[model samples]
Target: MIYLDNAATSLKKPQGVIDAVVSAIQHSGNAGRGSSETALQASRTIFQARQALNQLINGHDPRQIVFTHNATESLNTVIKGIFNKGDHVISTVMEHNSVLRPLYELEEKGVELTLLSINDTGTIDPEAVNNAIQANTKGMVITHASNVTGDINPIKKISHLLHQHQLLCIVDASQTIGSIPIDVRDLDVDILCFTGHKGLLGPQGTGGIYIRPGISIQPLKSGGTGIDTFSHHQPIDYPSRLEAGTLNSHGIAGLYAGVSYLLDFGVDKIRDYERELLNFFYQELITIPSIKIYGHFDSNVDRCAILSINIGNIDSAIIVEELIDRAEIITRGGGHCAPLMHEALGTREQGVVRFSLSHYTSKEDLLTAVKCLKDIPKDLN
Candidate 1:
């Protein structure tokens, strides 16, 4: 099968990732719970994974990278924990459900939310951020890139602007973390959330959040931390503050292998190649009059290697099912969890068929997808 649904999660992981997960499950024990050999093994593996994440994002320290189950958890930990009642936060319509849902929950709890609007192509102007600021606006949350349209946000610029207003900045980098180069220190972002399973090319059940120094987020969930068992309150530390209970050591070990591979291979090289595939597919898609592709298509633009399209006015689900059955191609269809984005694109009902590419998605794979799309009309008859 030709897998193109990488935005959901990367299916093809490196060999080291597979081996590391297996080794972790077989040999490692609970981290920070004991001093036995197996426990120490788990501790070391998790530490190494944090170190890899620190290097990948150019974080201030390894301990600043707090491991969570996925980006959703990381986002919630920041969104729900950082703000107070009546405080306002800013987000965009192009955000995933992870960002929107928590913000909605926060709104229900009396925190005011200011969701910015995106253009028809899913790009939000950075100026809209400056305009949304108010005295009650204590923080801003923006996705590094749109999962639906692959539009890359100017995170550094937005962070700088928010900082000038003394607003805390949280960037959800679920789509841009590994495939795109991100330096937490350089961006001066307060918190950056990521998932290991997507662009990071790791196993599932792995993700993290990077918080810069001097910024503190309250613990979302509190439990045993091995050191502060007696204390009723969660520990006020870098990692232990956010991390409670035993981590997913096996998945983290695999994430370490995945990130290490990206570091050695270089993120820029992977990005360049993926862009080549995106452009190849986009070029072919635009040529077909019946196909409607989303987002602003610019060959020189710095966007994620993803595309959203619809075959004529046909239902996206039906077209995706045809591709799966007849062409052995896998693509994501429907709203994709970003309801506001679908509304902005006037595709709330039709949804979209998303094709996300990674370093391994080749020219030949895109060619096959193009041919399938081109012949879909003939089959429909």
Candidate 2:
């Protein structure tokens, strides 16, 4: 089947990632609990993963990185750990439910929040975010890229502004990591959340957070960290402060391989390739009178491999079913866990079909998708 749902989870993981995961599971034991040869190997594997992630993001210290189950959990750790009652926060309407739900729950607990509106192109104005800040504004949370529209927000500028205002900057980079060129130090983001399965091309259940130095947040979970066994309180250090319980060594080994592969391939090369495919798909699909595309048509303003569209007189679910059953193509059709984006884009009533490409996606796949979509029976029963 022709898989096009890379934004949800990439199907074409690098061979190195698969091999690394399998090898780690076969050879390594519990990472930090013992001193045996197998345990030492596992510990080294985890350290290597941290180093790979640090290099990928141009981070200063590898110890600042903390692994989690997924981006949702990482985001929760940041949202719940940092802010307190009466604290004001600023976010955009393009946020996924991972960000939106936590903010909504915080709002109910008397934490003030301001959600900046986005234009029809799904781009948020940094100036609007600056204007939304109040005296109590403790943090500014922004999504590096919209999952539904694939619009890249102006993060560096926002980060600069937040720094000037002395407010913490939290970025949700789940959709941009590995596909976009991001330097944690250059971006000046205080907290960056990421997932390994999407653009990183790693196995699921691998994700992490990068907390800038000098910033402290309470841990969401507290237990034995294999360090500071005698202390009742959780260790107040970089990773040990955040990480609790046994880590996902197998998934992290795969993630390390995936990140190394991306570094060798160069992020710019992957991005350019995906852009070519997106442009080809957009230009060809626009000619079909029955097809309606979402997001900005201009590749410069809003750029990513993800595209959302709908066929006239057809339900999105029906289109997805037809694409899979008849055309042997795989695509996702639903709100994509970004209900607020759907509400903003006017696709809440009927969720649009999503075709999210990756570096492995080719021109031939786009052509096949276009042909299959054009061949959908015009007459609706």
Stretches off by above 4 angstroms in model 2 are 377-381
Error of 2 at 115 (Å): 1.1
Give the Cα RMSD of candidate 2.
Answer: 1.3
lDDT per residue (tens digit) for residues 1-381 in model 1? 899999999999999999999999999999998899999999998999999899998999999999999999999999988988889889999889999999998899999999899854467677899999998999888998989999988788888899999998899999998998888889889999999999898998989999988888999999888887889899999799999998999999999999999999999998888888888889888888788888887877789988999887788998899889877899999999999989888999999999999888888888888888988876785
- Which residue ranges in model 1 land beyond 4 Å of their true spot? none
Q: List the residue pairs that clash in candidate 1.
A: none
Candidate 1, residue 32: lDDT: 92
lDDT value, residue 172 of candidate 2: 97
